[model samples]
Target: MKRVAILGGGPAGAFAAEQLASAGWQAVLFDEKLAWEKPCGGGLTYKAYSHYPFLLENSTPKRFVTETVLAAPRAGAVSLQLDQPLLIYSRFDLNRLLLDRAERAGAQIEQARVLEITRQGSRWRVLTNHGSADADFCIVATGARNPLREVGTQLTACDTMSALGYYVPGEQSMIDIQFLPRLEGYIWIFPRCSHLSVGICGKGEPAGALRKRLEQYMTEREIPWKHGSFYSHLLPSLHTASWRRNRVTGEGWLAVGDAAGLVDPITGEGLYYAIRSADLAVRALLSEVTGLAEKMNLYQRLLRRDFAGDLEFGSRLARRVFHGRFLWASVPARMVQFTRSSPRFSAIMRDLFAGRQSYLDLRQRLLKNLNGSLYEMWMSLGFRRLVPRKAA
Candidate 1:
């Protein structure tokens, strides 16, 4: 049996551990915290529902009215009410379930921080706070801003985008996505069980001012609330140019999940990619049966074929939306409504949302309707003498 080493006991690492263990491979997982609490928007988009059907059974899954309320400094506001519902749950509970499932699948997990990694001949050695470990293969799910900074990995730095959110009694259940012109990012409001999660994020140095501005926005809008005392942690905003350098599959090393820059950019969602990449990595390693290097090669190829388009498209979309006031203003709501109104558009949305098709599939559709899209986007942007910024 091949020995697999998984770094970080988050969703990505745990998923990989589970997949490998179920396939009879020995899997070991390590993380800094035995019980880590992730401070995310806590809203799981429908896009993730297909992969995590059991998310609704988490006992704390909060029922939020499935409507997207969008606001922008430029184009005012627009709301989207969908027949499909969206749900939110505590990140703490969600992660625990996955960890439990992985343990049940027979994967050994160690709550220790990995300090260093070295390669020797056909094996990789990982040094942790507790001790050292050797494995036939290594999976890096250390996330975007991991401090290890191993040489040869394609690393990128991102500006700090601040967010502070929490839940309080009598909070309304609505998913509000707000964009600020002064701030480079947006704020999100997601309902979680009895409490609500609300926070703001954006690029640039105005984050402190942005937070206060958000507080003011909430108060002015008469959104009844209190500023939760616990400060929200910083979320690393980066995606490496390349997930793997010399080779994805080396003598005995592989990269998966955020370490590989596989998160969805637009939604800031990484769980689905983490789980999907883990599944692919384990599947490939299992098929190898002997030559571990060959397994990594297959895993890399599969990930490229299956996810390259979405990753690229999402990055492009993220850049465009954040860099300008057009798309997030009123364009997104208008475009989504316009696209979903037609049967053809509905099918396309289904395929894309279901992950059955790549972003390339939607690209062609968008291109075919580029003229209409541009016109709608222009109208939504106010059509009042402002020029759309050139695409990056």
Candidate 2:
């Protein structure tokens, strides 16, 4: 039987294993912890649920979420009450679901840290703490690099975007995204059944900075939720410039998910992109006619075509909105009013939230609005001039 080795037990690796197993390939998965809880906001957008049905249909902890309350740090907070429901589950629960599915699909689950990986002739050898294993193909699914750095790969680390996540005792079912005035990151409150998952990310420079920001946000909001009980992780942004070198695949091995730097820069959402990329990897592996290197290149091309514009656009917009306290406090109201009134404006916000649309989508909408509503644009321009400009 043809064998495929997948590293990491995160969404990407598990998804890849499930995909490959469905394709009749024997998949072996490795990770340090099988039920380890990784730090994430634990909120999935509506589009994410639509894309991954298994999240709701066959997952542990069950799916719970339907509304999102978006708030900006500014005085005139623009609120977007989403009509569609979102998916919110524990990362531990979700990971277990995906991993279980992969295992059921015939992927062997192994809990071991990968020490190193090397190419051996036509096959790939993976060195793990448990021992070494060889496979016809290897997939690097490691969420983030640890001590083991793959050869011919540039392991570039960015300033870690720290996040604090934990479940609080509460009675709520909606998700909240609060833009904090003093911090670069916003506070998130996602409730599931009986407990509230609240935390904050960004703005915290050092490791412990997130805790301080969370304390201030909770205290200022008069929220009675206690702190000192939460999980934190470094949310790494994708190194956009290194996509080519990252090469989703090599001679006999490939990479997926955060291993391939597939995280969406703006939203810190990786499940969608991770699964999407894994699908591409499975396609390459399954196509008997395609060479592995060619398949790798194809995955890169698909990523560029599938998500390039949206990622870049989101990053640029995030910088504008998240760079300073001023815009965080004021811009949301302006955007909410415009979005609610104009279908064209709504499309722009949709593009921003869901990566399906391009940056040009917003640009086109703005230009169209400018052509038809010169007075509205002029008023916006006037308001911009009225505000004290500060560096974002």
Candidate 3:
């Protein structure tokens, strides 16, 4: 069996390990912080459940959210019912579950941090705290701070974000989002199995500022957030200029998840993208083709075909929705009204939330809803005019 070495025990690495190991490959997964609690919302979309059904199996501690409340600056809030429920899990629970699946599928778990990965001929050498190992292929799923410069990948600060939040006790039946004033990120209350994962994320914002904003939001919402465990972490966000040239695959290796910067810039939602990319990578790695170059090319093609546009489009939409001029902004409120009024509009949002919608057609979806809304307004006006004449 061909051997593969994967660095990182997050969704991407673990999922890849599971797929490769189940297919009879010797897959070894490495991570120093295996099953550590990450400061993430841990929401899984519809596609995640459908594509990987096993995620919801075996009594995973998760909460189902059916409603999402969107709050725009000074425009109040609007609630949209999700056609499909979202699954929210604690990061630790979710990571542990995937790692366990990988191990069960025959992937060896190594609790060591990979220090370097260098290609030697057809195989790659991985140096970890435990020891050095050689594999036919290497997967750099070690997140945005990956040290594999040989893989030709870099995550700049401009394209990254800093997120901070608290884990507090709460009853979570729905998800809540409050748009930041012209910022690239928002404050969110995501209900996990036992508590609430509330946080504020902003690109280029200092930690102190984000903390102050979180405190203010906590106060306004009356969440009783005092004495909760606080967390801060760095996450990758898509940048138009650099994301297009992200070198994800090379001679004897491939990068998945945050290592390749496969993150949604707008929402900072990466769980879906992470697993999906890993799935594609594993599929490509398992192909019977003989050439490593061909396999890497296929991997890049898969990413471009499947999700490049979505990430770019998400970045654009994020800027439009979260721009600080929202107190008098029509776009944000118009979107909320569209969601409130149009079933098609609501369905698209639901699809997006469900991970069934693509960014390729997001514009078309919005335009179609806008046209329908206008026609309804015109018809309503005509009927009112006719009613006045009949009364007269």
Q: For model 1, which pairs clash?
A: 167-196, 185-202
Q: TM-score of predicted model 2?
A: 0.83
Output the lDDT of residue 288, model 3: 77
lDDT of 2 at 142: 80
How many angstroms is residue 303 displaced in model 2 relative to the true structure, after the best TM-score fit? 1.7
- Model 3 Cα lDDT, one tens digit per residue, 39-119: 888888878888888876669788889999987765678798998888998999999999999999999999998988877
lDDT per prediction?
Answer: 0.64, 0.67, 0.83
Model 3 is weakest, by summed lDDT over 10 consecutive residues, at 321-330
Ranking by lDDT: 3, 2, 1
| Candidate 3 C-alpha error for residue 332, in Å | 2.3
Q: Kindly report which residue stretches of model 3 are placed more than 4 angstroms away from their true locations once superposed.
A: 324-330, 375-392
Whose TM-score is higher: candidate 1's or candidate 2's? Answer: 2
Clashes by residue pair, model 3: 181-324, 182-323, 182-324
Going through the candidates in the order shown, the clash numbers are 2, 2, 3
Across residues 1-392, which tens digit of lDDT does each residue of candidate 2 receive?
38988888888889999998977889999989986667765666656667777665762664455445566543333444454556677778878888988999989999999888888788888889989999888888886554546532344555236667666677665666776555556778877654677787773366576677777777786666674357776665544455444545566777777676666665677777778778887876676645767776776676677774466455556555565333233555445455434445555565555444555465566776754444654566577789858989
